[model samples]
Target: MPVILPTSIINILSNLFCILINISLFYLYTFKIFYSFQENEISISLQIIGIIVNFQEILLRFFVGYYDKGEIIQDKQLILLNTLNFNFFYDLFYLATLILSQIIMYNQKNSSNLVVYFLNLIYFLKAISVNKILNKVDQLLYITAKADYIYQLLKLIFKLIIICHIVAVAWHLLAQIETNYFEKNNTWLHDLNLVDSQWYSRYIESFYWSTTTIIILAGPKGSNNIEIIFQSVIMFATMGTFAYTMNCIGVILDEQNRKQKEYKRDLEIINIYMRKNNLKKSLQQKVSNFLEYLYQEKGDIQVNKNSIEVLNKLPQNLKDDINVEINSKIIQKFKLISTNFSQKIIQEVIPFIQEECFLPNEIIYKHYQYDNLAIYWISKGKVQIEHQQENAKIVLVKVLEKGDCFSEYQFFTGKQHEYQTRSADFTTIYKIQRDKFIQTIQKYADDYEYFNMIKDQLIFRNGSIYTNIQCLICKSRYHRENECEQIHINKNKQLTILKHLRNQIQISRKPFFRKCFYFIKTIQLIKSCELCVNQIKNNQELFNLIKYIDINNNSMDLDQSLSDNYIQDKVIKNRDNSNSSLSSTSIENNVNDICKQTLKNFKNSIIINSEQINSNDNFKHSQGNKNQLEIKKELQNINLLTCIIFINIQIKRQTDQQLKKQAQIQIRIQKKQIFKNQSIQKKKKKFLQKKNLKQENPQKKYNYLFKIKQTKKNTQVIITQQKKKLVI
Candidate 1:
């Protein structure tokens, strides 16, 4: 049977294998002690293993998926393209060098040290592959174990160890160069008397010297300027390393103790607040106990506050699922909800189920209290339902344990509580407020109707429920009967004469006939006032009199004339013969005669005035005809100027009309083009639909095609009609 390893296991194994190969190659290259082995078998074997590891890693890059941002990219082509980039070339070069060096050593039997050094350098570059191992290890530590402080501490320690190892290797390499290349006798190896030491001893001495100098700044004396310079450089690098290590340790310790510190600070703040408020000892003790219990129940985080923020950040579906999971137990407590509702309806209400904790013997509500009317379900501990008797003594009604609900009757009926509720023990309750629950269920019409029906049935079975008395004026349940009396008083105060006039004016302004009627009434009022009549005459207001007469004639005509004649005759007769009135026929005749005589006299006066003006103008003309010619010439010039202006206005009007017509024609053409495009799109969609129908249902294919042809005929008719209209 073939073993199929999981992706995580495969990744871990590959990372470990790469780390082992890199470390082994690093050690062999650094020490070079295996060079003394027969035929250099150990070194050759290590190099071969490294070449194999590198080749496999490069191959895996083409097959294995990689993470880009947060998403895993598993496309084979993408993997191959990415593998051919910079890392691929570097790996290929390293592999070729290893192979070449191995061949040279095998062929020569005694290859130059340069080839080995070159191989060492190439392997040193391969050390960067250990990053993959560190990354996987980091994921295991921080994600799997969820110990950030531990991961950070391990990271800092690993970095320090790598730095120490590199420094040790560099120190030994420098010593080798000084002694072997420069032929010097005053190197660090000579000073320590380790020139003839075993490979292990030399390595131990170099590591010890590097660690002491980097960490404590104390080691064996340097015998040359080159050694001193190297020590100084190491000292400077050590300063930075030490600073970084201290900072990492500080952060790790702080993270480990953060929760404890927060808890202590909160406890101290609560105590200080209690002391500042001068609260009673028993009350303070109760508060402290509740705080302690809260911490024990919810741990370091404030679950209610933090959970609300977390739930808000989550998607709607996830939030709904979480709410249902946490509060599904309390859902069965409600009779209406459990019997009449489905799981879907219950899920809608779950989001509004808020969890609250109560201390032992704490009063959740009192008898007859109108506020805090919510249905409560006991999820943990017990609740004591109490009632107040006629004698004002509290009686225990019942003890409601887990899965029991209370206050549901008051919530549905909008009534005050009949009995008080107190916690018998440290209880946890899931409460759903009446308003929120009603609003949420209202979104689903069927659910809301069924809920209402079920609520009514439940209320009927539970005996009489108190209903609020609604006010008659405002039609609100919250207003008292006495408060309605003030509305009547305010209405009466607002209905004064000025207010009535304003309302009539506003009404008159709304309609044409009302406005005309109002204008006629105002004219009648002005006619009745003698002072207004005199003012009109003095102002040459004949047009006002004529307009008033024309309006009266249009409305009343003959009756208005008869009334005026009768009134005038009555007034004249009264002056001539006291306590006497004239007949209607005589009054009408007398008024007509008086009007004719006045007209004749006015005509004679106008004729006489015209003759006098003509006589005066002829006398002036005899005195100077030259002045008359100059006046005629000035009049001709004024007439010509007026004619030119009128012609220019006519030309401008013609141009404006032509431009307006052109704009209208362009707009109509653009609209027709848009309609054509829309029609074409519709025809294409219909044809596509017919093709799809032909594949799905062969029988419907002919029907769909006929429909499409009918639609095309109708569209063509519409286009032709539109074109004829545009031409017209």
Candidate 2:
């Protein structure tokens, strides 16, 4: 009969078995208690944390791995650490799997990964926060792509099956413990009375009492005791079942996936053909599609992915894509995508081309003009291109300083056209004729290497970048597609500026050469100023502004608005704010006495509006001349109003001296007409201001206009006056 072991003896044996198993797994730890063990090693720290996290990751991935993503090929090196210092296959598999499991659960590391690895592996002397760790954790999310699911699932199942089987074996191993290795003992082998007389004493293996019947399965088949025979059959069947299951699983995982592999091979073949054929669209689309497929298939729990992790670090391709689109549009607009040409160079370049002489207000080009070249480089100065609108003038573009080019396309394409061109300031341009440009490009492609890049970037080669800036300010980006400014610069404007400088030269009584030089410099400066550029939207207004400059006067310190193109003049105290003053005392009395003597020699400047302003409602709004003298009126009447109103507005608007001069011209014409009247001639001609003119009393020391007389012409007037009152 079989003997049953005591409960006390069974527990003592089980406890001893548990200790032996623990000692085998963590033998080094037996040297010290868990608390006393050194926790300094980074790898060890990571391993300990990994022990807990590995199981968690396996569970998390199991639910989603198979159908969620595709297979990923990874480097085997990162997993090599688990294969270290191991003999048994099961132990090596378990350790390797623990590391693999964690890596698969997490996403691939990034630049932040170095921080995470160090933190996880080593306990830092300094403190760190959980949030810091969480941040590192977040970076891993990107690498856990959908494609790595197959590997993740297979890996999880393999680990789980092996671990469960090991546990069962461990329990079974514990159940058959015997105190003595050499002496005879009744082990679990006799529980069902299957052990023969020599079963325990014989040198046999397989974790059961060795018997010839058990090893050969011949004597063991005797069924005299049916219960013992049944027990033997059951144990044998159980052992065979577990072994077969493990083998089957290992084989299934090792099999090749022919379908996925075939698809990849076919895709590569198509991509290679597209590249060889130079099919741009097809090639680009294929590349993009292939990239999408790779990411979709290869990145689940996909932690610490080798090469794939670096892909996210690549420079973004979106901007390059946008540039491609822009370049495409630019190319589409061209009449010829690629052309070869030749040119004959001429030695005698136009003086205007060499000297590049331009005043600030000089018109550089006109609209509807054609040239064949596509490149224009700015050599010096600034330029503005403007457009005409229904209600007002709009700035189309602006270019400043050197190296700006405009309208090189006209010379190259063999198109004859007319367009208005203006200089934002006196500017120099290196003009290249299209024929010459084509010949040069054909001869020296290296110098114009940027041509292709520009084409690729889609920047237009024709328009000046400065003109574009002005246009941007005046109109929204949408309005650029409409008609650009190409109106003719009126001759009247050139003459107006010329006359002002001519008058100044006359007043100085300087030599012809000196006067001409002075005029050029003054005109150039004013032309470059913001006050002129911003207000000179159209040709007519520029003409009037030129007319308004007082040639006889010398004060020309530019206000900021004029220099900077600002609309508002913050300097120059407004009359509204200038009213406050101090009570006059002895010093003021002395000043008044001096002023009384010279006051008689002064004459007020008659300011005028620009002719363009007079024609437009915007100018009317500006003038506060609400009562429309809008119709052509006596220049004298308008002159007085413009002068007074000019003082109240921004200094950059310019004094309307020119428009007031126009009014004076009309007044003189009227006077001439009156003189021509048959009976009116008989009477002494009467001046309009004669009645209001202050009489020079013999006792009065002061003569405000001692020698000044207002001489009238056709709506124009001139007063001989001292320079002091007119200037400051």
Candidate 3:
């Protein structure tokens, strides 16, 4: 028969087992799981707290171990002393025992009625809280760090606990079954008499015993060697489980710590950058708040922590896959993209689509600003579009929610925004920058249609209604309803005016042309007339001689008839050759009169020539007398030159004597000046040497040299001045 343990003993051992289990898993729950989630200074404090918490459990376990011993440890003082050595609140008890007990109870290590239950409840609460914290940490780590080891370990731990419970239940049920079978066969195994009414009682008893045996190191007072071996095996298995869990927790902690540190470092770098840039307090606060919001939203999600950096670092294929997956929803939600694009085009644009986050009331873009280079599609939260007036008043035009987009219309059209868009709350959006959009679209042939559709849609929406109905030409609205006032001339009127102007110009030009033509003709006529007159004048002598002969012989009519006949022939020929307005008869008449005049003039000139010739002879005789007088004057000038030459020779003798004496005096003065300059230079050199011997003062030496140079310069100037005076 198996020996059965006392109920009191079993209860104490069960509690002891629970405490051991809690102690073994304390680090795994608190430090490895919970504290590891934080990548900040707070995490360090948490880790310290975890260490303290785990130590508390261990201390309780120590107390239980010592308490499990027999009455030999009955001395309360000894028990207290031993506990105090390992306790965190050992110093608190020195002042008062009352305070000490209260502290011990508060610390969950009091020895009093229901103390064990209280400790049990405390351990259970700790375990539950730790577990919850661990779950949260695991979720964070899974998202941001994308760790698999911790997840696998967590699953394994849960499975192991279930298996442990199952194994314990099965073992206890087997023992109970064996006992029942023996008793039913009326055999003496342990006189186990089981009835239908006691089934619940029996089940509870088995479960309790199994739990105690599997968990507690101390075996139940029992029993066959087989039962002892079973308990011992479970004990050994639990220790192995503890060891495995510890090792797994160590690895998880290390990985978590590494990621936490990196996150912390990045945040610290951002803060440092803000401080270094002398950012405004308000701006700094905004940045800090935004970062905190991001942390809260993503909470260590893989797409939050270094995800962008990772994507940048990834191979092309993997990068595209990730980007497409992340941004596919964002693209699909956009009305323009979904309606006009193909799957292929969407995939092509995925690379250009970047996720952006903004805080509440954050300005995404300003009204009527052309500087924005990207289109924003809201994936979460609402955006407010405000129209800003010229007077700086803001009017809320529209409120856009999920699946709605902003900036795309103006962004694509390359026009200024009609309204400003701001985040109504913490917002997540997908944006495609201008350069990236163009680059991506260009790579895919199908994307052109999609891009065109977007452009067309934007154009339609933006131009759907004319905000201001002012005329484009005159900028007037009320005077002309939806139309511009026409101030420009019609085409027909313009052509008529131009033609009229041309006609007027032609009419005005007629007089000028006529005048020019008449003047040219008049010049030609005058030239021809002059030529004819010249020809007539050249034959004047012959004509005049004929006239004179006729007059003297009393046959003037005969001579006139001959002269007129000759003049008529010459004038007729001149008139025939020239295109001037002259008649042959007129020319003949004028020539006849001119011939009579020339005959009279010739008679008078002949008489005048004879008188002038006599006067010229008398003038020549006077000029001959004047030539004789000029010869006599040249003879006097020759005599004066000889006397002047004698005086010049006497003056040259006196100047030559004076020049010789001056040259001798200048030579002597030059020699003396040279000797004096040489002596001065020697004195200067001696002075420099003496100054050098006295002390090596560069300043003094420079001053001395400067004084000497000045003196020499002055002396040279004086000498030159004196020499110049003498020369003069």
Candidate 4:
């Protein structure tokens, strides 16, 4: 098991032993006259005590657990190693030397005093280490106490005493050492006529000299060079010690007067502000009186505000408990809350119960004020409610003291205040807004219903029935402004109003610029639409088909309608001339085929134009250059002819698909027959041209034509021979 010693007791005992050791060492060794073996009973007694204390400490090093980096080490091996590493060997050496010196003094009466001096020196060194340990213990005690000033003063006094004792012993030692160089009578001790004085008297004189020199720099002058040098060194060391002592005292006094200093600073700032604003003396006095009262009542304004912020950072449950502790009495005073609400509901409302302070006669709320729609509970001081009679006389209604509530009926009724409320004195009140209270209770269904019922009862008792609340914006009784139907309508109306304003501004501008801009935009749109239409019209075959469809179907009028009609008339006349060759069904089939092809081409053109317009819109949107409104206006200005064509295409798209398929098949067959007929007609034309050339130049032209025919026949015969060889 580890041995545990009370550190406080150990520290006290150690300090006592250290003082005894220092006194014995200084007197017995430094004076030398008191070093007689027979007369050193006091010194020997101290040495015996020192031996016991040192032995106890050595045992403690091994048995008692010591702090290693804040944790206590109790393992025997580790504790033994730790003890051996620090001061254990040195302590053992000192103990051995002390024991040897004691043994020598007892057995050998004529032994040298050098051994006693060495033993005293070792004991003094051990005492110095004990002083350091005591200092650490003092610091620990000081940290655990509240009286910092007292602890510091005590510590300073103790250090001064120790320094004086050490210096006194050294000063006498220096004087004794100087006797080696010169006669003993020539030293400072002899100059003071005290060389043969008793050891106690000599020690007292040395201590008095050290104290005076160190504290006040007032002491006898040195008689020799050694004495002068020692005195000068002591003076320098004391200068710094004195400065540090004064500094510590100053810090203590400053801490004690910190509050007063802050108060003065605040007052100075207020005075400067008043002077800069040039306030009247009477008003300034009133302000000063208020400030005095504020400071007396509240020690520091910033401290209170900082405390509130600190409280807000606490956990919610902890804050709730604190709030309950602060306002439980005030909450119990409210009959409506205490009787009707559950504990949980009361806790929920506590967070929103804000505390407000008011000065004497400060108007908290005026009569019929819409903003004062919250319940007030007086937590401190008094409140006075004043009502104005119909005869224009102000009457004091009642004086409300602590725990009294006002405006409870108004809070539930959602009505304006009927009386003015003012603070009767320096008052503190807790306010709970009606909306926050309702919102908190809403989480509990039963509590919310009960609250509403109480609110209705309160309103009825005041001779006013609860009615539906109308929307503030639209005056609709069914819903609030946020839920009103007119909100979207109002938004659209705002847009229209902005548009009208813009149009009015444009009308006020120069018409020439506006007209030019509109004309340019229209021209650009027309050009784009015409470009798309012209691409379809540039196809000669599709254009011809369009003309035929326009002539036969007469579905809609077009730019080429007159020409188409004229061409149709000529074709009809030719058909009339060859009425026997062509039947009516063939004419109708041809017309139908032409119409189908035209409609297909029109649909494809419309699709391409639509795709291009959509792509342009996407590009403009990506570039963010043109807004949606501008794009819409440009689309609206498209050519009217394209609109009509699109309408006609849609109507034709609804036609029977079987007729279109049949027409397509007939058209393909007729195209092949026409191609064959054209080829045969070209051959006949070539033969006719050859006959004409032969008639014009009989010999040479006819031989040229015959040679061309012969070359064609030879090429055909060579192609047949190559085919026959491949077959073989």
What would the per-residue lDDT of candidate 2 be over residues 1-728, giving only the tens digit for each residue? 12212123432343334333322323222111111223345534545554554344323222221211222212233223322333234333454543553464355533134543343223211111223323322333323334343544454454434333333233223323331343334434454443443322211222232223223333333223443444466457445544555565655555434445555676778778887888898666867576555443433213324433554555456434433444443332222222221111121111112223455567766556554333345655677756555575655544455654455334433444333457765455544355544454555465345344433332344333222312233443222233334433344677788878774434566566534443448765555454434533543533443343432122223322133231122123333212211211332343334333322221111123344455676554646453334323323323433453344333423433433354456557767787689556454434433433445454332342443422234224333343445876
Per-residue accuracy of model 4 over 294-409 as CA lDDT, tens digit each: 66655443555787898888877667777887777667766667677899988777777788878788899998998748888887889998878789888786688898777776
Supply the TM-score for candidate 3. 0.33
- Write the number of the candidate with greater lDDT, choosing between 2 and 3: 3
| Global CA lDDT computed for model 2 | 0.39
Q: For model 4, name the residue pairs that clash.
A: none
lDDT of 1 at 169: 79
Judging by TM-score, tell me the better candidate of 2 and 4. Answer: 4
Can you write out model 1's per-residue Cα lDDT over 350-451, one digit (the tens) per residue? 778888877778888898999777988787889997868789999775678898777766677777887789998768887888888778778888977876
lDDT of 4: 0.68
- Span of 10 residues, lowest total lDDT, candidate 4: 461-470
Superposed on all Cα atoms, model 1 deviates from the true structure by an RMSD in Å of 36.1
- CA deviation > 4 Å runs, candidate 3: 1-162, 165-206, 216-219, 224-226, 240-303, 306-315, 341-344, 367-372, 387-395, 440-728
Report how far off residue 476 is in candidate 3 (Å).
22
The backbone clash count of each candidate, in order, is 0, 79, 5, 0
Q: What is the C-alpha lDDT of each candidate?
A: 0.67, 0.39, 0.55, 0.68
* Alpha-carbon RMSD, each predicted model: 36.1, 37.7, 32.5, 35.4
Residue 271, candidate 1: C-alpha displacement in angstroms:
12
Candidate 2 or 3, higher TM-score? Answer: 3
* Best-matching candidate per TM-score: 1
lDDT for predicted candidate 3 compared with the true structure: 0.55
Q: Estimate each model's TM-score.
A: 0.43, 0.18, 0.33, 0.37
